[model samples]
Target chain A: MWKRDEKKPVVGIFGFSGCAGDQLAILHMEDSTVDFFTSADIKFFHMAQSHQEVPEVDVAVIEGSINTERQLKELKEIREMAGVVVALGTCACYGGIQYLGDDEETFKERMKYVYGKSGETPEFLDLVGQPKPAQPISDFIDVDIMIPGCPVSEENFVPIYTKLISGLLPQKYPMPVCVECKYEGNDCFLLHGKFCLGPVTAAGCNATCPSLDISCVGCFGTYEGANYPSMIDKLKEIGLSEEDAIRKLKMFGGNKVEQALKGD
Target chain B: MKTYKMPKNVFPDFIELIKTKGKLFGPVKQKSKYSFEEIKNLQELDFDYQRTIMGVKKFLTPPKYKTLTFDKEGTKDIIDEPETNIVIGVHPCDIHAVKILDRLFLGNIKDPYYASKRENLIIIGHSCLPDDKCLCQSTGTDMVEDGFDLFLTELADNYLVWVGSDKGLSLTIAAGELLTEEISDEDIQEYVRWQQKRSSMFKTVMPSFKYMADIITLNYDSEAWEQFGEKCLSCGTCSLVCPTCNCFNVDDKILMNAEGGFRERMLDSCTLPYYSMVAGDHDFRPDRTTRLKLYYTHKLKEYIGRWGQPGCVGCGRCVTYCPVDINVITVSEALFGEVCETKEVCE
Candidate 1:
């Protein structure tokens, strides 16, 4: 539950190491950008036009996941200072694409690939431990609300933010994008022999890809009731193999698809 | 509303009558697929086709349109128009899509651009006679009861037109002498039978939209997502073909002189790594797996809960178009469970 104040709820938008598309999306809300700024008392939004001190917030919206040691500490501090913490995008809600290398060895290999042979690592104050696999904010801290989008859709973000400012908890959305795609009357991509991920992806985007003469690539992650095996089987029947199917499932979904396949 | 049964020869006469008012646009053959375009000849219309490659929304919110233009003097101009156009041969699913867009653009803030186009366009829908890939019946969107000026159901040799709105009634009157005032109960009943039979052709039926939400939430930590992500190429083909993916990127394209430029907005997908990039060079979704998961969860679970409807229409386009073959229904059923006792359609 959220409580509204006369001066507008204290809102903070923070980000970690991932792409800033989610924050950029906020900037892309050109029509409502001024309204959003005027309506909410933004305490911290690092990616936007300002970079002010982080203050106590009623609702702290965090983007990206905890991938580094510093991110872990900052997230903990954010949790301590905010009344409610919301995961703003797929990165925060489901670890985004950075968590692909879930295995410790693979993660280290990739890190080494990028960081080079640095025998001496830089030291910093408040450094805690070695970085673990990237995990959604919920895996580290309690997330009151999870806004899941590759970059959160203005359709979902605006209303949720307004409700939070007004002291009302935004209602959760449950349908998949396929439903909207059907309503749009576009031809089914599958029938035309095109692969799509709409059946399993969530629906805040209003099935944008299908409307544009393309198929959903499952950017928003899995819906609550995704039927993974059936989807895979259908893919195989239509000329894909089980191996290819698994690879596609884990592209954005990560270990979630692995567990579902094993009936875990 | 009056109904008339035009003879076979009167088909050309009806086309002539409608063409006299304005340009007639219907499903036209483009390579292998059907597209809605202006029709100058009756033979060009492909009424018996399966479905159009794209929805009728392009008429309202086109893929690329200028929202605002600015000059050196800080002068900004917004482009909007109120024009009259007629769209024909729209399938039931497309008509439903128009209604959804209406709810999105008009139901909420009343988007001036979309509203203007919506108000100016006249929609004529055709009842879908089930195809092998359609599952609209299960999704509750197979019929064209509303959101159209008129609806036509194709019979054996003639077409039964149901005038739904004042615009449709006006169109009917304009083509008056060609139409008949008498329509039989048998004709309507036969049309209904044809529709029901058409629905039976679909192979896949998803679970209730409510159940879909539960499946995604309960299995957040499921392994299926990771497996799918591994094989996913992250090419963004799925989102591009999705009918309801409305995410876009806005860029200010400056002219050579730098005095003025128009702000250009283009479609974007979360599946792309750069989709979430910020000014500080931080890329939020760095891998393909996370991008894939974001799309699935949003479509099946989150958006449905917000809008009170399933996001997918059971169109098999994603599965068909995906180069990597990441079928959404397969993943959804694998997480939730297959629709039991229902015969599999895709086999």
Candidate 2:
């Protein structure tokens, strides 16, 4: 914990290959932006400011997955400078949706299709070096804390930020989205024979989709002690085939769901 | 208890008089489902519904509510002035469930929050016919003699209102000309016939429900739990809808500026993950099977051992709402069936 005599903790916000939606989520905290700026010494945040320099910081809040060799090297440098590292958003924690396309052949083919005519490597690829399969930052560096969500919900982010600035470790929330869904008083989609992954998805979004009568897509990743086999069985009972159930479970569950499937 | 007969035509005037006592709330249809909502007048009330999504507990211990607010100056309890809320159309099983909650929250150790809410909130129970899902008959909560301020039993053309408390007497007195003390022989015969008819409508009954305490203990290691666990989602819908389930988790949330924060208590469930989790991430019931066992054994067996009554009121909320059909009836039947099949092996 920071002492009274100690200076305000300097914090750095960094992003890698995935969409910087997590940082945007933090920026979207209009009510807390002024307090956030005043509480911490934000030394390096390119999205919010310029003239960014690579400096040793108290905490590094990193978002997105390590998707390239160049980005991985930069991440190592950030790891060296920061005292504490926080993996923000689903991408930094579970590699996000890009984990589904993690195959070498699939990654290369998709890259070629998007940026190349047919066979030749794109100029950007040559400039940035060969792209790597999307993987969470924890695969490369130690992460002190992880805030997992597609866009790192404000309810989770704000409290974590306050704790980080106060030099306290953030608390973990292992509850599933169904907890919030029950609080919202929304009718259970599973009861209605609709496919909802809320039972296994990490909560913090306050059952946002389910409240609106939409099924949870597992964007927040698998919750702790999630019953994967049971969830799949339920999906199948709701008319989803075995193959489709596993595919849906892996949609945003990423490598974590894959690991559970292996254990099963 | 004082019994009064109110003719069908005079009920509207009595209801209008009762509305003046407090905020009138009753079961109202929301889409195909029913919920306890604020009723503007008699037209909004729908007593024909089987069950509301939530029960009287929603008024006592809400899903989420503030408990305390603290800042640099210290802390203050966040108890708002108790409002007199009169909830109508509660079923007898739900009334019994409230009585169970009262034993827990208002007995030797009182919960101030629940006590405050319970003191001000009035429960007006209404009669209900049994459906296929209802098991209140087996649980012996089909007809409640108490735990309600006023219980209105609907007859063919009139209502037999049983005043259970001074609050109920006050309502009757305020009703003045709308209520009559006259009791007819035909009214008694009609009430008896109505009770018989309602009793015959029960379709679901758990065999040896009272003996479940021993059965649950003997079959503690039965494979029935594993089968149910395999299908259980651990979504907590059972606890959420169960009127007798009253577990809660408290959290302190800091404001963005770090100047202040408030403590909040939200409804929690034993079946949900982390319900038995402590600091250092040590979870007592880490697997779904163990959690499922705790949920069933606690409600079905342990509650009986402690309070001489099962924690479940047999309201059939779980029977109606659980995505997978792993309710008290299925669980008790499965365990009982397992014991019967293995009688020779055990003996």
Candidate 3:
């Protein structure tokens, strides 16, 4: 009988500056937690445990965006060490909410609003560049896969992780959440004069908010063929202004919105 | 397909006939609103109700379900529950929603849980007399001609029943004793007139869906999103009440002391800040503006492009349920233009 390879595929979990909800969501997978750990060789995970070291790994699951100089440096090093990199959440995949301010002055103003005059002092690192606007991992590194949820859903994570471990790329869910929402049998909020984002946002969440008697806020990123202008009109008909509509789109899928604004 | 008419007096017998097979669910008054619930007596049925507070989607796809359960031994068990039941007096929008779901779960991969429930249950849809809040006609879903096993249309003093499938035919045959053989042409004409009148009652017609994708594409930075976000509480009410919002979160429920656990999938909303949080303390949609934008795009634009159908069916339940009353139609029209006056005819 042939002996099987004893070594397991090395895995690493990394985070950036955000609420850390995605990590908590992963930890919330109580049943799959042990299996997730046992399935791979977790070389580096800073949030779940205290011990941490940068080791070359087969796959690196990165969360958050390239916000600070330290984050950028760390991300570059992770890119060098890992063979494959997966942008694990909306923050890492689409720049999340931190990229709300597209203009430099607006971003600076928002920073001032939060930190005041004393906070304007920039933290400098000798080697790395200054902190620029927050951006998804794809802007800096080639992301092999992207799981785009505000906090990536466990429903998506399990299947995706399984595929990754087996050396297969998980298929992108081209369908929006409205497809699943219809399956769940909730009422459509739009007809009632309520605002909803089910049409343009990606569909992985299965329309949870609507089912619970709320409108979808589009935590998931935009689908491949999202149409923004029409949706804005729909919202406007329901009484929202054009400027407000675009701001909402920029909150999650800022990069895409920027591209769309540029008529790309 | 066969159509027949029964006297208004025969309605009681029809309820009794349905009761012979199993439980019958129909509209019932709960507090101030109408809802679909199990009826043991005919008196509990509300034949004249305008709409139900909740749609009949849950009977097919439940709020919380387990796709698969796994233990430490690596053994996995998928949960499947198939039950036989009947849903009476379903509205047109809800029936359309069910049909959309059928395309997703039954027509495609055949979700065992959804399939099992759908296969066993019988749907009896009702045509409504339009109310002020109803906009189904605007979205082209005011009347459903298919998807239900049997369709009911209320006439002057009776109901005109249309059998849609072999299952419906069998059920009609089983209830043959209660059904009347003779029906007048005037009753059929009156039913058609009522439907036409109902369609006309809807004051708003949703903009053509063909231009929806393009409209959303053009208004990516229209600046209207922030206005709504400023007022948004992020309470997640809009997503919860929407008929087609299907986002969910899965987690494991471990017993005390970490002895064992079962992975459970529960309803989750994108409106919540934690919904997009990642391991590295990063939140994808930290601001309310982006979250709100996501909800609108998914329903009006992204869904139609991907699934070949619009996500929203103009039910108006969200408007009714929202504390802030952020109307989707108004927002969409503001961003895209008036549905009636927009350029580029959808072919």
Candidate 4:
């Protein structure tokens, strides 16, 4: 470890297969972006900077989930090198929308549909090991922190970032988005006969979707210790099919939701 | 209370006068709905609006605000009071809501943040036609007695204005701009006639629980809550749209335990699932039915006990906005006629 750059902690940003939406959110933070940049010496960020050398970093903020062996190996290396590992989007922490094909067999079938026969790998595609269903980084390496969101909320991310830079541990979110929705004075979409996942899902985006008159698609994943079965039951009672309810629950949560259901 | 006669043609001049005093916020059309927005241009005012989606509570007790901004070594107060301003085209139902909020925020707690906005406010109420969804009359909030600075009733050729308080007299009308005559006896007659017309316009909700406080209190074990909870999304929209809902939650974020952090209070709704969740995850009201009952009890019974009036101002925003057709009127009707009976009758 290079102990010389003590003033600013060396940070790295990495992305795998999922959409780069969460990283864009970090870039979109106009007010706190400067503070974040000044506080952390970004050593590896292929999306934002030109530097290609994957130098060891003090803090590694990894976005997206691992669907292939190459990403899995890279994630293991990151966990070994970085002092702190933060799984920054829903994909990194859970298994985001990319985790739709829940079963390994289904995942392979879907992959086959996207990329023909497995024997021939395209020039653009690089696969080091056999592909599997999308999975959270924690499925392989130990994650120090998990800040989940389809695109992580700046309201939640900025404050937590401030603490992380100060060498302080940010508090884990145990509350649901319903709390923030109440504070926002937004009408309940579920009450409106729309399928809303706010009650069982996490908060911290200031209930942005509901505020704009749209139902939450569980972009933040289920809240810690949330009653997922009850939520699914309620969703069905309100007209959402069991299949649809489970789909909505797993949209941002992926394998994490399955793990939660199995009491993991 | 003084009275003034403003000709139909020069209403804009009076608007200009109010604008000069401070910021002018009035009813304006937003898409298919209506909203109370800042009137930068005089022509943006849409006095013909029935209701706004958000209540004026946004002015006095805003949803999100900062209480303190501090670094570890020091602290700074960030409760910036809004500028003095006039809220035009307020309905009597909404005015009563503002009164309830005053009682909630200013009476017992004396919230400095709320007081900062409440003190600088100038309310201008107007006559409105009740729609099918409006039930303000049923709740005794259809017409306010003394909250506004000015009250306007539109007539054929002129707008009959009632100067409610000394603040209303602050405006000086130009010689030719105003009628410059005593408000005629015809003015009073026409105003009273409109009051009678407005009183008769409302269609009374059936099975009306005149003593709502007692009805809700007695039905502690009512199954109506279960039925309602089945339809309840627990999104807390009812409380958020409610002019009388004054629940708030405060949280502190201290930076590294070094530099001072900040404290913030945000609008909270009782209907939300986690409203009563405590440390170690002991939820006071875990189910939607219990949460719904808590809201109804607070609005109909508890608030009445504390403030001598029912919390619900009968604005019908909940009814108009509810996706499952869960209006208070239908619920009250159901409670009295059928659902609120004991298990014997319910079974």
Better of 2 and 4 by TM-score: 2
lDDT of 4: 0.75
Q: Between candidates 3 and 4, which one is better according to TM-score?
A: 4
* Share of reference contacts kept by candidate 2: 0.51
Q: Candidate 2: which stretches are off by over 4 Å? A: A1-7, A51-54, A115-120, A126-129, B342-347
Query: Chain A: TM-score in each candidate?
Result: 0.89, 0.92, 0.89, 0.89
Q: Give the residue spans of candidate 1 off by over 4 A.
A: A1-264, B1-8, B76-78, B207-210, B277-284, B338-347
DockQ of 2: 0.49
lDDT for each residue of candidate 4 in A207-233, tens digit (9 for 90 to 100): 898778888888898676455766777
TM-score of 3: 0.60
lDDT for each residue of candidate 2 in B194-260, tens digit (9 for 90 to 100): 8899988998876579788899898789999889888887778899889999999887777776667
Model 4 achieves a DockQ score of 0.23
Instruction: List residue ranges in candidate 4 displaced over 4 A.
Output: A1-14, A28-31, A40-60, A69-85, A111-127, A138-146, A167-264, B80-82, B172-181, B204-207, B252-262, B339-347
Candidate 3 lDDT over B226-263, as tens digits, reads 77775554546566666667677765443221223455
List RMSD in Å for every model shown. 12.7, 2.7, 10.6, 5.3
Of the candidates numbered 2 and 4, which has the greater DockQ value? Answer: 2
Residues A161-264 of candidate 1: C-alpha lDDT, one tens digit per residue: 66566665565534466655644545566655668777667667867888898778877876654667667866786778889877877776654565677798
Q: Which residue pairs in model 2 clash with each other?
A: none
Query: Quick one: best DockQ, which candidate?
Result: 2
lDDT of 1 at B330: 64
